[model samples]
Target: MITGIDHVQIAIPRGQEELARTFYGDLLGMSEIAKPAALRRRGGCWFRSGAAFLHLGVEEPFTAAAKAHPAFLVDDLDGLQSRLVEAGHECVRSDGEIEGVLRFHTYDVFGNRVEFQQLCELG
Candidate 1:
């Protein structure tokens, strides 16, 4: 039996750690966590916010994950959307297919799709 997801790994162009930090850390509100010494030489970075962990690994001739993505649960969906828009990131609102849940999709600095969602109070 499986427990839970350890982390979501995303591929990025080589030497783009600073860009990842700005997008995932400064913009997304996640904090950069040091990679293990052995893995540090591989040139990548990790970030964590609460229980959600995202790892960005360096890849040569990288291709963006435009379809596959990780959906993050947020408390303040509207506020987050506003912040992302204010920073020039487009927050594409999701269609109301899933009931009582609000979500939007946005691309990271590397063009990987990321989803943010919030549970709505069903009256």
Candidate 2:
């Protein structure tokens, strides 16, 4: 009994809220939405795309992903890469068939890796 992805959560070490906002909001252009009432005091942030949501949770020390992450699909890979670089974020290349799509990864300000994807036929 499984449905599609509900949301992807990442842990952000303390003292990096500003950086997270800049990267996820100002740079990446994802809309920042308020977390649920119960999670408001947690001190992190949430961002949403069309049908996907990313929950940035606050933790003592930032932890990298072992087998989890949010893979965001974009229409323009080159243009997106350019914008990310302009925003001072580096995109790392990866090898995989992600959702039957080609994609790459970039670390959020909190050192949490986020993936950017595009269909191979479109590239």
For all candidates, the clash counts are 0, 0
lDDT of 1 at 60: 84
Compute the lDDT of residue 10 as modeled in candidate 1. 91
Once fitted onto the true fold, the runs of candidate 1 whose alpha carbons sit more than 4 angstroms away are none
Off by over 4 Å in 2: 95-100
Which whole-number lDDT from 0 to 100 does residue 104 have in model 2? 80
lDDT tens readout by residue for model 1, 70-114: 899999999999999999999999847688899999999899999
Which digits, one per residue and each the tens of the lDDT, describe model 2 over residues 1-123? 887888888888766777788888888888999888998787888999788788888887667674467778888877888888887888876646554576788877766678888887533
Question: Scored by Cα lDDT, where does model 2 land?
Answer: 0.79
The ten-residue window of minimal lDDT in model 2 covers: 93-102
